[model samples]
Target chain A: SQQGEEDPQALSIQEGENATMNCSYKTSINNLQWYRQNSGRGLVHLILIRSNEREKHSGRLRVTLDTSKKSSSLLITASRAADTASYFCATGINFNKFYFGSGTKLNVKP
Target chain B: EPEVTQTPSHQVTQMGQEVILRCVPISNHLYFYWYRQILGQKVEFLVSFYNNEISEKSEIFDDQFSVERPDGSNFTLKIRSTKLEDSAMYFCASSSDLEPQHFGDGTRLSIL
Candidate 1:
């Protein structure tokens, strides 16, 4: 089952602009993670935020989580054409069970 | 960087036939999982395995589907009777903890 749903099914932005994608989940979670998938390729782990943590930063990517609202957001600063890919939010439940979202397709135009 | 690997990147099989998808999770990871994505659809969880046994499974993992870790490093998912709807990209993932599961490229199964 899909527990998380990402907003803005598709996003198009110019290079150097900040791109933001939001995700909302239905249940309590242990942690939330963001992944990047390029076309038909496999997913690459980007960052993870625990439920207790409100925000985290890894390089040019920033993730924020709000447990009360059951929502999270991923912001990619200074987007590049190479950053054009689909982004998915995955919620980790008990015992390593993960439910993934429908994903937001981001297209960065250089 | 250590990564999960899946074999037979793409496979074509006929309906009612049996097919097995293989995976090799990160060597040190303790938890393994299987997920699938239908064309243009969201990824769905199938099963999670730990310590040589299934830890959890979804409703989609019925009698027709089974998962096993036949050896120390290999994990496999078998479909006893393939259906047209089973055509999808099956992904294998592993995590050392409850968070940050790393994923493989996935195997595309096309049922004819």
Candidate 2:
């Protein structure tokens, strides 16, 4: 079963704009991770936020997790054309298991 | 920056036939997993393997599906009697401890 469900199935933005994607999940999780996939390719790990932590940042990416609300969000600041891709959120239930959501496709126009 | 590698980028097979998808995970990674995505669908987890045994599997992984490490460097997923619905892009992933999983480019399997 899918754990996370991302909102705003698709988003279009211009370069230098900020893009935010939200994900909601149903069960308790040890961690939530975000991933990026270019067209027809494999996934690339973006960021991860643990249940004990509310937020985390890496480069231009910011991730927030709200255990109480059972939701998480990813924000990309100063988006570039290269940032155009499909983004996904996955909830880790155990060390070896992760359940992923249908992704959000983001298009950053140059 | 080691990455997982999968072979036979695309495969076309007949229904009811058997097919094997192969992957070689990062050498030092301890966990391996298999996932699949039907066109325009979410990536779905099929199975996870550790210590040369299956640690977890989703409902989609039925009796027709099997996994094997086979050798030190090879991980494989085999489907016996493939169905047309099995057509999908299958991905292999590996991770070390709590690190995020690294995914392979994936094999596009088409069952005719």
Candidate 3:
């Protein structure tokens, strides 16, 4: 069974627009991470927010986690065409393993 | 720059043949993991290794799959025999204590 699910399985926007994707999980997590993968490629780590943290940022990426809701959101502000990719949220629990969400395919039109 | 590296970027094998996928993780990372993603599907975790042994694995990681760190700086995943269902992109990831994992480019495996 999948522990995490992403909303809006697909999204499309202009290059300069902001894109947001949300993920919800089932169990207690030690931390949550966001990753991006270009088509047919390996995942690239974006940002990770510990259970104690509510928000984190890297470059134009902003990640927010709400443990109470078992949800996390990733926002890419002023996105570029290069930012287009499939975004996945993974939940890391006690097992030291990460369970990934189905992923949200984001298309940034140039 | 320091990063995880995988070999043979792609592999094609006959069904029922043995195949080994290799990875070289970051020099200082202590944990290793294997994941797979079929075309148009979400990535799935296969196994996690630490201290030279499997600490955890998913249901998809059946008896046919095995992992080994034969020597320092090298990690490998072996499938005793391949099946059509085994066709997918296999990825290796590594991380140190309390750090987010770093991923390799992955090996695309095709079962003929």
Candidate 4:
């Protein structure tokens, strides 16, 4: 499947610490995007790293893409209690369709 | 910021019934898509529509499933005959060109 696999299905950290999640996919992609879903809510786009781009950042979120390895990582710096949510990595391929990973459930304790 | 919107936050229907989930995508966005998450499972793509036609669809979007852009701003997904397995959270999304898709909170469909 084109769906990616995210390591450490769940992560717990303190509010001031940094949290990192990794994702690996099996095929080439046009772009890799990170999204956060607050329980029972829709996905909120975080950042997108193109196949040719190695890294990208938006606010407190930093994303890195290693197309040669078909892997990506998302780092949330100085996490806050409100940052608790499930984060997913989606690989955008042909026809603009996206295949999503199972996601990492993040918990930030205040 | 513009956003995608879906109607009937939650719907309850019997098996073998037809269900139509409606969505109003972000205005001026040229691409529309439908996706579903079966409880704890990963989000799965259903179909993508552009230029008033289906650009691509997954295996799950079979003959029993159909999509339409009946009007300028509305995009809809119709299931001919719903099944228990059809119970899920269906999401609508829209994007312009190669931009990231903006998603709606989603419609929770329950098939009894």
Top lDDT model: 2
lDDT of 4 at B82: 96
TM-score of 2: 0.98
lDDT by residue for model 4 over B4-110, one digit each (tens)?
A: 99998999999999999999999999999999999999989999999988998999999999999999989999998899999999999999998998999999999
The digit string of per-residue lDDT tens for model 3 on B1-112 reads 6899998799999999999999999999999999999988888999999998999999999999999999998999999789999999999999998898999999999999
Q: How far is candidate 4 from the true structure (C-alpha RMSD, Å)?
A: 0.7
Candidate 3 C-alpha error for residue B91, in Å: 0.1
Answer with 2 or 4, whichever has the higher DockQ: 2
DockQ, candidate no. 3: 0.79
Clashing pairs in 2: none
lDDT, model 4, position A16: 95
In candidate 3, the residue pairs with backbone N, CA or C atoms under 3 Å apart (3 or more residues apart, or in different chains) clash, namely: none
- lDDT (10s digit) by residue, model 2, range B1-112: 7889998999999999999999999999999999999999999999999999999999999999999999999999999999999999999999988888999999999999
Q: What is the TM-score of chain B in candidate 2?
A: 0.98
Q: What DockQ does candidate 2 have relative to the true complex?
A: 0.89
Cα deviation of A110 in candidate 2 (Å)? 0.9
What would the per-residue lDDT of candidate 2 be over residues A1-110, giving only the tens digit for each residue?
43899988999999999999999999899999999999899999999788899999999999999999999999999999999999999998777889999999999999
Model 4 error, position A41 (Å): 0.7
Q: For all candidates listed, what's the TM-score of chain B alone?
A: 0.97, 0.98, 0.98, 0.99
Model 3: CA > 4 A from native: none
Model 1 Cα lDDT, one tens digit per residue, A1-110: 43889988999999999999999998888888899999888889999898889999999999999999899999999999999999999887675578889999999999
Cα-based lDDT at residue A32, candidate 4:
88
Worst 10 residues of 3 chain A by lDDT: A1-10
Give each model's whole-structure lDDT: 0.92, 0.95, 0.93, 0.93
lDDT of 1 at B82: 99
Provide the TM-score for each candidate, comma-separated. Answer: 0.97, 0.98, 0.97, 0.99
Model 4: per-residue Cα lDDT over A52-107, one tens digit each: 89989888888999988899999999999999999999998854699999999999
